[model samples]
Target: MKRILFVLFCFAVTSSYSQNKISKNKKAIIASVEKHKQSLIKISDDIWALAETAFEEHQSSKILADYAESQGMTVERGVAGMPTAFVATYGSGKPVISVLGEFDALPGLSQKATPDKNPLKKGAPGHGCGHNMFGAASLGAAIAIKEQIEAGKIKGTVKFFGTPSEEKFFGKIWMVRAGLWDDVDVNISWHPSASIEADVQSSLALIDFKVEFFGQAAHASGDPWNGRSASDALELYTAGVNYYREHVKPTVRMHYHIQDGGQVVNVVPDYSRLWMRVRDTKRSGMLPVYERVMAMAEGAAILANVDYKVSLISGIYEVLPNREGGKIMQSNLELLGPIEYTDEEIAFGKGIQKATGKPEVGMDSKIKPLEPTREHPGGGSTDVGDVSWNVANINLGVTTAPKDTPWHSWAVVSCGGMSIGHKGMIYASKAMSMTMLDLFESPDLVDKVKKEYKERKGDEVYEAMIPDGPPPIDEVGN
Candidate 1:
């Protein structure tokens, strides 16, 4: 009995020591983020003001890459065939940890840092998705981890990925194909959301493509019979898609934008273009719908006597949820407690909620409990989903705007440029940094996270849904 009691006592003492070490390291990491808080906010604000679009974020990317380099990390810019994409690395050895940062803004959402809807520049781009915060906070976390490794408090490597064009082209697809994540043991990622959660939910899988129709132009009234209208084909294709929607599963979502239709009312258009996207809960589920939709374009062309071409833009996989990683992230969130808001911030949040036609409940200050992984999660798509498939990715969502503020809108842009978004960005940096410290300290934790990732991945092989050539850097806008 005494021997057994002694063994248990030793185990307890070792566990206590481990917990103390983790706590101490997390405090240091949090302090590092605090120490560089102003610089981090400046990075976010700079990117926010630049409001550069996908693949065109040259200055935005430079700001982040320069900061990472100044922090003693080696940066390789213009990577994976993208001028805005880059990789920054620090330290050496096993358990390579990677974090993703995106700095692209949505087009035509240009708004100033005011609660009222005021455009900073009419018909310009804005940080509606809060990627300005996403990139900065992620880099801040990576820098914190880099500092720990520099101090000999942790072992292994830390990599920061500057993945651009996520708003349109799914930039990470090309990055993954270039084998950027091949050596990574794990990835830490987060998004600026309206609520805080250790995101265990999977995202929708999506496919983006453009359909162009060609025909012969003629005056509408002068030679009606001689003209075959490409605009007619465009209309029929959209009509066919609408009719097919009722037959699809509840998990399916389809959207299209008519980029070109007709030049004038007096002429039959010879050319028309449409940007189409198809999405489902899983890539496997999305494939058949994408195929059918592509086929519909051919049918439309035949009926309208026009020639149509379908060009692949890009596609992404659903996020592979890592329960092991999520559990660790949840602990860190709980440790940090809910984000407290000052009265001014709360009133600002309420004003946003009111303006956006939602209940004036203000921001969600509570940390949402980790949710069960849904088989058919309902939400938008992301390029991070592709990276998660390649590596064990722990995802997080921190509130950067008020509750129920319509995403990808001026409301989010308003808060993201001000203190509300700044607080959340800092909060995300601390939570992610603390979680990374746990991963760095516990190799067993990394093993468990990878084990879960492999089990979930099973026999399925990852195949990117892009064309044979490089990413469409020349593609116009979001």
Candidate 2:
């Protein structure tokens, strides 16, 4: 009876603390984001114009870091050997809360900000994944936390991790390797998506590697018999992968891009190169599949009388969703209310839906209920998975594009460049900042979040699936 009474007392205190803490500063937190509305949109547009990719996002990275510094946050540039990666910090002491921001464009997706399909630069890079909005929203959240901390209302640390190369090389792996996130108590992250939701889902664990085959070149008509065809090996290896696909599980995905398949068909080609990506719902599920794929490459090389080299480029783990954090974010989402879209916005959404062959249900403004707990990841993979292993993290997706508009496409790029994207960006900023206030006010909540993280993660150690050298800067950038 005494223990039960004490439990009730603790719950009461925690409840009061949570309510009083976030409720008091909620207006100011929102106001901070509202104040930076136009500037944030300009920042997003500048990054979209640059359209840089992966480890080569020098201009975009500098723009984000410069803005963070302008807000009076201490900044560190060129972290983890990637010039575009950085960590901006404010406040001091324990219970370090961090926000993640990514700013990388996809290659070959350039599009003008129009309802119609018009390429801005005809095959140039573009913000197909809406990363332009992702970065600005996170920066807005961190700056709001800085406002509270500076005013002496919050006594914890606020950090913003400027992660680059998310679309290709998985830059956060190096940042995680550098122990940048080791001391963080909790991390907040969000993505621009088709709907607003507290993401309680895991992403796929993936690995990317490149294979190069070498052979002796010879004249096709004269000495063809004396020459080995590297293209033959490449074709054979890909055929084997396709044949083996029938035996693998449905959740596994294997894709490849043939960067080189010989210049001319007249002469026997000497060299060929290709990149491969392997993914699974869980990390363990990927090991055997990768082993079989590699073995097939060896067999192909042997049969084609050529030598092959395999280089592991980059790999990232599936996101481990934190329900505790997800619930907190959901509650905050409810507190903020649904997104209000104007008639013009709805028409704009329909335009994108028409262009993409999707049903014109317009934008998804309603906040979805929290997803049920699951062991396996969803479909896509992200570098934030690595950071989740190191710290307690929650990833939310805000409705930045039209409903049913597929991500990583020109359709998303077009919507993300305009007002629709700005509204979602501001919404995410408020949600993240308000959620951070909950953690700042109540240490009990932080402990609960950590305890849940430890329990879900178990005793498994983290190991990055990359080679023992620097990130593939030149390979990915060039």
Candidate 3:
């Protein structure tokens, strides 16, 4: 009995010591985030105000890149043929830890930083997806890790990727083609959400392409028989897609935007253009649907007697979730505890919830239990999904908006520019930076993450789904 008691006592001592050490390590990162809290908030707010879209985030990109440079990190701009994309690195050597930072805003979601749905500028761009917070928090984490490396508390290089155009073009796809993440041992990423969790679930694989129809124009009233209407082809294509939607699996999603159909009612359109997107739970599942949909475009052209062309914009793989990494992140989240809110903040959250037609649940401040990786997780697509295929990615979600508040909407835009978003940004920075400390401190942890990545990837290879040539930087701006 005495021997067993001694064993238990020794185990307790070791476990307590280990816990204390981890607490100490995390404290440093928390302090680092606090020290730079104001600057990070300013950065996030500045980007939110700029509200630049996709490849046009010149001012937003400069703010982050310049800050990185000022902090003594080597900054590389115009990376992977993207004028707004950049890479910032600090420290040197093995186990390069990369963090992704997106700064692009969505078009036509402009809103003031208020609970009410007030557009800061009507019909202008805004940070509806909280990317302004995303970029600032990620960079803050990287800088914290850099400080650790400087102080000799952690080893290995820390890299920050200033990824742009996530909303439209998936800029990381081009960066992947350029082999930007080939050598990175691990990547840490986070998104603003209505609830906090260590994200270990996959996202939708998506394909984006444009289809154009060409036909001979004729006067609708006078020479109707002579008209081979491209608009007819466009209509038929959409009809076919809608009809075929019922036959598809529940995981499949298709969307299209008609860019052109006709100039006026009096003339038959000679040209029609549309942007079509298809998505599935996996890339393998998405390809067959994409092919079938493309074939429908040809069939529609045949029916309308119009010439058609399809242009590949880009595609992205679903995220390969790393449970090993998620476990580490979950521990950090539990250690940090739930985020606290003042009465004003809670009321602000409730106001957003009400405006968005959700229960006035305010903010979900608890640390959500790390969920089991879903075989078919239902969510939107991301360029970071491509990055996950390339490197072991640890993803996190922290609440920056009211509970159940609509994403990519004015409610998100409003919260993202205020103190609500700032608090979540700081929390995410501490969580991700603490996770990075683990990767730098423990080689075994990094190996476990990479092992999970390899097992999930199996023998399949990663290939960028974008067309050959430079990213459509100039085209997207127009």
Candidate 4:
């Protein structure tokens, strides 16, 4: 009789504890997120004003660090050897949840926030990728979680990673190499897009390199024979790449733009440069083809009689899917509800779409649930791929741009700087905060995710695709 009574008492105590934790979490996070919304807007506006480029986000880093310090978070600056990169942490315990933030802008996308495309400063940089919102939303989630921890409503840790150089440099890859994510249990991130959805598929592995050729210079009209045209070498290299494309795997993608094709036709150009990017579904599959491309560049230099050099800038591995993490994030997304656009916001999106000549309004009226099957691969590249291999990681996208506006465009930048973008930002923050709450409320879910991650990574070691060296922060300004 006494044993039976003790069992009943224990059950009642456990139930009461669970209920109290849930109630406290709900109250704490709701109040925290509400307080965080205004600060998120301010951070977004500040990033938009700075318009910092990849690897060189000095002002953006300062803004994030300042806000994080104000929240009483322990901040680590110049992380992973990148000057603009840092990690801010709060709370003290296991099951660490990380919210990744990017603050990089695209080059030559300068534009005003207007329906008609107008360059704010011709040839200047702009946040066409909506990273302004990206950083702010992630910061908002971190702040909300921090509040929950301070109120003694949660026992786990929350981290905010300020990742730089998403546009050119692979900032997260270096951080991964530096073992910054080793202690993290799971990482979550989101991007500005035309729709809201949790990504369940993988992304391509990518590498960027620069090819330069050196030759003798001479006057075109006076001594053409005395010069070796480096521009000719660049042209030959491009032709070789075009020819090599027909023989490579169908999944391989090679793209290049001439960075320097000589000074003037009047003088036989002495130097030329070409920036190249190579991507494939798998890193191993990409290596052989990348080698072939290098051989082609060498062949071109030999034929053109010009000295050539190839410099690998950065490389990132493909993302590994995390089913358990995806499910948790999807559930929180459902709780947060879909982004409801105001009549004015919808009118603005439509106007931008019309001006851009894209007729589709990709924004749906209802929130879409996570699909059961992974049918398509993520078409873009990210440094997060490197983090996914180390820990269970998943990313989400929220509609902040017009349908079919294409990333890194003036149209996307225009919307990102306006109120329509702020709405998306808030939605993402709420979703992330709720997702973290779910993790805090259900400890078994974290264990399941970690177990799955271990099973998936079985005997597979994460090797940084980038070389072991200093961060390529200098490349940010260029």
Q: State the C-alpha lDDT per candidate.
A: 0.93, 0.90, 0.93, 0.83
Give a tens-digit lDDT track for model 3, residues 1-478. 9999999899677556645756676788889999999999999999999999989999999999999999889999999999999999999998899999999999999999998889988999999999999999999999999999999988899999999999999999999999999889999999999999999999999999999999999999998899999999999999999999999999999999999988899999999999999999999999999999999999999999999999999999999999999999999887777788999999999999888789998889798998878899998999899999889999999999988988999999999999999999999999999999999999999999999999999998888999999999767743
Model 2 gets an lDDT of 0.90
Residue 108 deviation, candidate 1, in Å? 0.7
- Those runs of model 2 whose alpha carbons end farther than 4 Å from true positions after fitting are 1-22
Error of 4 at 375 (Å): 6.9
As a whole number from 0 to 100, the lDDT of residue 416 in candidate 4 is: 85
Error of 2 at 142 (Å): 0.1
Off by over 4 Å in 4: 1-24, 360-362, 372-378
Distance from true location, Cα of 96 in model 4, Å: 1.3
Please write out the lDDT profile of model 2 over residues 1-478, one tens digit for every residue.
Answer: 9999999899677656655655668878988889887888888999989988988788888988999999999999999988889999999998799999999999999999887789999989999999999898999999999999999889989999999999888999999999999889999999999889999899899988998899988998898998899999999999999999999998899999999999987888999998999899888898789888988989999999999998888888888788889988999987776688999999999999998888988989888999897776566889999999889998898999989888899988998898899899999999999999889988998988898889978988999887888877877644
Error of 4 at 404 (Å): 2.4
lDDT of 3: 0.93
